[model samples]
Target chain A: MWDYSETVKEHFFNPRNAGAVADANAIGEVGSLSCGDALRLTLKVDPATDTIQAAGFQTFGCGSAIASSSALTELIKGMTLDQALHVSNQDIADFLEGLPPEKMHCSVMGREALQAAVANYRGEVWQDDHEEGALVCKCFAVDAVLIEETIRANGLSSVEAVTHYTKAGGGCSACHEGIEEILTRVLAEQGKTFDPAAAPPPADKSGSAGARLGTLARIRRIEHAIEAIRPNLQRDHGDVELVDIDGKNVFVNMTGACAGCQMATTTLEGIQQRIVEDLGEFVRVLPAQAMPQTTNNQ
Target chain B: MTQAPAGIYLDNNATTMVAPEVVEAMLPYFTEQFGNPSSMHQFGDRVGRALKTARQQVQALLGAALDSEIVFTSCGTESDATAILSALKAQPERREIITTVVEHPAVLSLCEHLEKEGYTVHYLRVDRKGRLDMQQYLDALSSKVAIVSVMWANNETGTLFPVEEMAELARSAGVMFHTDAVQVVGKIPIDLKRSAIDMLSLSGHKLHAPKGIGVLYLRRGTRFRPLLRGGHQERGRRAGTENSASIVALGKACELALAHMDAEKTQVRMLRDRLERGILAQVPNAFVTGDPSNRLPNTCNIAFEYIEGEAILLLLNKAGIAASSGSACTSGSLEPSHVMRAMDIPFTAAHGTTRFSLSRYNTVADIDRVIAAVPPIVAQLRRLSPYWDASAGAPLAEPETAFQPAYA
Candidate 1:
């Protein structure tokens, strides 16, 4: 159901270097169980060479999170602390072919853990945890500084994208407005414009995500409605054939018993009503002969 | 195009495999008996009788006074919509609806819509064991309440609610009562004629029948309004052509369920308990959710601490096992299930909740396979869990762990 990559499944099923380094010099942890993902990275450093001698990770998360952590470990096994810090979330995802866009946060967690470990190795305290910036996503305990950094680093322009990258707006969504404000402020500072329409709102009770469909989607939905209604129409020894669609008008041809029958109007009306209900009330249905020019284009 | 994957399915709460008998009973209707039940011919007459028989079978299963009480619909959601909306329509002056916070989305989503439409909905909370507090439920009921729609059993935790008693209370208060019995009908006995429940909704697939066929049981004397008002289908209650084949399948499935009710309770319950106990014994920091003493016979919701559920399910899938999880990550959301949250389950343990729902089709060997496969998977995930410090035998590596609130 998740469309997880085979490589992700592979690493999750057989995770390498899974567990904490017993006596590691540096340990970095990020995320929490409440956020649906958490990761801890333990790095053993060869101080003379300034290289990561070994890396072990513990991840409490979904398959993608585990896979990303495994990939992070594999990527930074022999790299120096600075080199390991340069391993982006993208690198972890690239190691596993790719992760679903919604699961990108897992890779971000892996990269954050690596950075925290590197910061710890250098005797530098990670700047988060005590930031005075107000908390935005209370569900995930994500505060303003981290959200700003993630938005700026990823050039995130939408709340959904921010959630995917930071696991911030993914819970409760009470902080959606807060996330929007942060996005707008961060994008403005970077001289980039934020588009509010890029991400759609939550689906209504009808389960329809978008209020209106594009031209292609409208045509597809109309065709699907016709497909569903065709079999029932055949039971009455009649059939409806699509001729062409122009603007909001759907042109069709009625065949067999429906062609010149007294009930032809009723049959046409049924088709028109069904199309309108599925597409929208603005849709108009008419006979192909009534609208000839659109037929030739088809 | 390919062979079906061989796996042990334990996701019955999500949906169950269509019973072979139901399939056998439905095959003819798809071919020769495929006539509109509204038609004026012999073909139509045959289908109409089949529809009547199907209604009768469902009526028998629910122990309703008459087959006329059963109104067939598209699915559980449709049945739920028809019931809740019908109640509100019947009592236009009543602006409040009483329901539990742990209801399936079918009811919860409707409540949300109703709330947007200027209706006050009381989402009664559940305790740590996912049980509704009776005192709180009683406090929520008032004359302004149009309908009290609580689930007979929770889908997530399989916790049984006191629906019969609750319905009686609602009846005394002059409020309509509906129960989404989707998770309970086939797994347990129901005698609606003896209960004060005004309406009940059930899905076909949950009872080993095909999907797309559901029933709304409205009592004979109940005031109601139709949700769909087109054709004179289901006595003009629901509109649309009858899913004749599925209706027949549901009837046969109900008959089969009635025949196997004892085994479902005894053998399936035994298997479920064994699996739950086995997993708890083998895996540390794991505990069952809901009232362990009063839950559905064939369902178990277990939370494995430190490790997340999706990772465990993935490994289980690799081991040819099928299950579901309550984790937000599993659903592609950021928060765990509302049911778990309502019960105040710790965010740490909630993320790792897995639901293994059994059906009558499962065997002892299947139960054994799950028991044998779960420990290793838990161990593997725990190994990769930052919270799980095996040497300490407790959750570790946290400055927040000290502040983490304990929840049963």
Candidate 2:
């Protein structure tokens, strides 16, 4: 399940300024039904004062997307067109506390939709739809120009990050090489080196994002695994005690029948499997005797 | 330390709640019985005996002739990888594979990886009803095809494939065949003894067992190679120490499934039908996906027009209803489900598809709550949808079926 922020859930459940502005003159739309997410932003602008009077939005997307759209409307309601134009996708994200990296595209869509709405009010052509880059991701119909622009804007360095920002290379994986080339070119222009390994390859969202799990969550996961495994050891009149975690290696003390058991290696491996498989951590289960210096270390 | 209680869970196809019986059966292994089944000591002997019984239980569930046919693995993906890779290794002379376009990621991702390694894979497409084109399957089978790995039932649509017929054809073509029967094993009965399927994969979690336990049923005398080659476990068919607790849980889960199979076909089906009928009646422009006559009794996939699936699911979540979506946004992908795409389901309808999969644990009140919850959720999302208006009557699907090219 997505760890949607409470504010996001709040805005999604009880959105502010939903539906169209009753007397709105300008409307902007982004995304297609085929894209699986779209937003239409309507604004009621004051012609004489040029200050924004009201903003409303209708969104067709996930909870975060709806929340982002709602946040976009709320933020731009009292701001001038120029000020609203300055509201970035990150600002919308910050407004909602945060969005999952994979769902950053939702905020991007909100920003684009807002910009398009502002441009429509000025009777100016929308720049977002006028880009002429070749299609980079056939799955999402994302274009090369957009991918390169998003990479430069977000300072993205990896295909996975590019996917988060631009929805490029998120499907079929046929466009990952293209995304990598774009990332390399953009990062080189900014004089920053692009290391593919720095952000890992494209994986399912949970595995890729789990790389950032906090130490508390990580230890809790270890405890949960041990809790599941300790029952058997306890039933056998044995137990495994967690001693210390030194980076990737976890030290544990085996007591009772497990201390001198012939299959202690196998039992440790079993515990390791439980921790490493779904927990998305690079961890090793080692005997406390394997590393005796942890007690003396800070 | 506490939060909202888990709501009415309808995402059983994604993963079922582990049965209490399965939990009770496996708990002893975690505490007092954590012995390596391979040990020569009394502890090992006792574990090994329990493991043998678990194997027999799984064998009985599938109605297989011998218990030795079942090889335990970590999950359905591992079993799938093992079966497909083994087929290729055992017949290195053959470099081609045939599978459906709508297989679970376990099979589809592996096939896509194999394609990068210069192996040819024929991804057969399904019709509008999520039925595979038999002619395509027959045409794909040849001397060069090492294996035909089609899922017995699609996870998204719950459409059953003609695996028995496909397996027979592959056998006559001198090719191995495997089926990812993860969704079919417990929802429906399987008599492997009467079929020619060379290998089959089933996940424990889908059938009320905990995750991380699965079985690959390789027909006796079939040439095979181990995916994890190290230990003498699983008769050397798979390597690594046995996940004894989960393996035992899978055994008890299978036993319970065998006992409840009839109820799944009858009572569960009735609940699913009522839920479907109720929602369709209350909601406008809603259409059920997949074949009506032939599908898993527990699955009901409905598309609410003019609204996105994730938005509907979010509203349902607020109503304490748990369901899954085929929408691209829900999957963290750019395209909707490959199953929906392959079936030429239009983009307008495809992105709105929501799946409700039940288990025997569900009750009439659970269905009633869902039926009561969904129409309002759909109405709420449709009200928020840009394309939807209160006065609008219905919506039409996009005409283009060319985006996801059909298997020609």
Instruction: Please report the candidate that would top DockQ against the real structure.
Output: 1
Q: How would you encode candidate 2's per-residue C-alpha lDDT over B68-138 as one tens digit per residue?
A: 99999999999999999999999999999999889999999899989978999999988899988888888
| Shift in Å, residue B241, candidate 1 | 1.0
Q: Candidate 1 at residue B232, lDDT?
A: 91
| Tens-place lDDT digits, model 1, residues A1-298 | 6888889988987888888786788788776456687788889998898899889998878999999999999999999887887887778888999887568778878877887888888898764342223467756556777899888785667876676556576657899977887888898898976788875322233334357687788888889878877876665467888988888778888887668865555566557656665665456678787886444443
Q: What is the DockQ of each candidate?
A: 0.24, 0.21
Per-model RMSD to reference: 14.7, 15.2
In terms of TM-score, the best-performing candidate is 2
Models 1 onward score TM values of: 0.76, 0.77
Off by over 4 Å in 2: A129-298, B1-6, B391-408
**Model 1 chain A: which ten-residue window has the lowest total lDDT?**
A200-209
